[model samples]
Target: MATVDRVEIEQAQKLWQPQPGWLNTASYGLPPEPAWTAVQDALADWRVGRTSWEGWGEATERSRAAFANLVGVPVADVATGAVVSQLLAPVAAALPPGATVVAPEVEFTSNLFPWLVQAERGVRVRTVPLAKLVDAIDAGTDLVAFSLVQSADGAVAPYDEIVAAARAHGALVAVDATQACGWLPFDAARADVVVVGAYKWLMAPRGTAFAYLAPDLRDRLRPDAAGWYAGEDPHASYYGPPLRLAADARRFDISPAWFSWVGTAPALDLLAEIGVPAVHEHNVALANRFLAGLGRPPGDSAIVAVEVPGARERLERAGVRAAVRAGRVRASFHVYSTSDDVDLALNALTG
Candidate 1:
């Protein structure tokens, strides 16, 4: 009896095969070996016209059920999409005109763009200051959308607190958790709506994302955008009369690429098998190692500030491909990032 649950961990590690010099997992890494091979095997069957989406579809359903179980939610509430944008577009479309959306400065474009466009239409877009973002929500704030962990600075905001504050003011909370998955423990129990990208921390490919819709708010949310796939009847091709959408978050989903769904199903299955808590612990151990490697000096050191003199140039010269934002350089971490990757990144930063 392996009390540590190393059974799934071993299977996942063998399944998600990584390439050489692959420190860029935060960019996009393969899913664990077992799941990757399983997905590919399933895809091969689909491509050869041997097996249909039935097994994959059933697997997809099981994956979501497992995901919901991992997040402490009901199976019926989760929905899959080709990307987080598709799942969130419904929430964006359903927003009242001119409503204010509060977001942090460190968030990704996927979380910001959907709400920012509303500014031109009378929706007040407020970028909350880094320190006060948690306490900034008020009665007038229509919604507060942000990333659980900042992709730019690696600074994780107080997500639970932000949700509580925004909800107290009657504002909806939307979390873009692309960087948080596999790295952080995500319990969607308190979040009104949260989207996760499978490519990054989740160890899946691009165009595969999932959304968790808080059960209580499902009815209140209207799908401003809908398609045949979004309807309750997937086989409903008559198109004669208006078909009612799914009762759950599935109504928010649009054209889901079944292939991508097939790919994600096993990828997530690997995670579910390894267990979210264990994966998160492994990732945090890596994050702590890399953060400790960045030995930038204090005071005038703009290591974290919006602007830093020669820091970006120096890092580039040292072989670190850095993304410059607000005059700062940031490197992200994911599960496959081992101590060697951390040391290499640190060596580059220092040299």
Candidate 2:
């Protein structure tokens, strides 16, 4: 039996409702009111010249610590990247000069491009079927990178099998956990690197995210494209004399996005209030309602393929703003989304 948890769920949905034609989470990621309130304060603080390198330095440390706490890891092992792109930097740098980076066939470029461009060092990138990923990480592959929940299908990958396979082949695993961050609970023990971009479910603004490098794997990464902050003595060192990189994952922290720190905190505070599991259940329930409303797909299709044209049109005709990608209608159901909101989306889709 599904527990009815419309209390905070309704608040989140009502606060972040989408207008017509608002389909993609990509184009219009709706954050809660509290998130906006936080960002507004951060922006005001920024305008007043309250944030500085050191101030942000402390903020970065705090954000990283918060992220580490969320992922169940020690703060010392966490790295703060202003954006998710740099989050992949350490993983790319850690690979051998000439290595194969294997990824699932369909992926957000966040997980694909960094490795694809690795040809400079003779690093080969291979696109494999998602179903075969567990069997595909043979001795030839150096690192296997992909998202835990693929963006296209909204299908959560079997993390345990993927990790076991990579470990069995002695390969490092880099998970683009942007989609799974709030949708599910993640175990850091299963992955060497778990990079989560905060914009989507964490309800943070763009340019805000964190990358968790497994404590044991922290020492193995070579900080490529590092800066002053990468060093332990960055504060006192001059002329970049024999630049020393940070011994911990803090080496990855270049600087900070002052505004995101401000805008992101309120929602984070709310997340702390509602709790992760409850939020996850809320999302799951909405997805279930939408999926159930889809009823039975055509004999062959399990869910609507996003690539199919008019998915947005069809959902719109039914009365809800929706995105059809891969093969599922990707809908956002937050703490604010009520049974009515779920019913609205489902009714619009199934009608």
Candidate topping TM-score = 2
Global fold similarity of model 2 (TM-score)? 0.84
TM-score of 1: 0.83
Report how far residue 165 has shifted in candidate 1, in Å: 1.6
Q: How far is 163's C-alpha from truth in model 1 (Å)?
A: 2.0
Alpha carbon deviation, residue 65, candidate 1 (Å): 1.6
User: Model 2 scores what on Cα lDDT?
Assistant: 0.69
Native RMSD of candidate 2 (Å): 3.8
| lDDT against the true structure, each candidate | 0.67, 0.69
Q: Please state the error at residue 174 of candidate 2 in Å.
A: 0.8
Residue-by-residue lDDT tens digits, candidate 1, 1-351: 343634444445555445423444446656666556766787778778996555665655655776676677776788877677767776776688878888887667888887776666677778876578877789989889888776666666787789889878999888887767665676776888888877777666577778898877667777766676678875673276667788877777666565666666666766666676766555555556655556443221001222355656665665555466555645554445456655765665556
Pairs in steric clash, model 1: 15-32, 15-33, 15-34, 16-31, 16-32, 16-33, 82-207, 98-122, 98-123, 306-326
Please give, for residues 191-306, the per-residue lDDT of candidate 2 as tens digits: 88888888876777787777888867777777775777667766754454787777788787766676676656566666766677777776666556555566633221111223
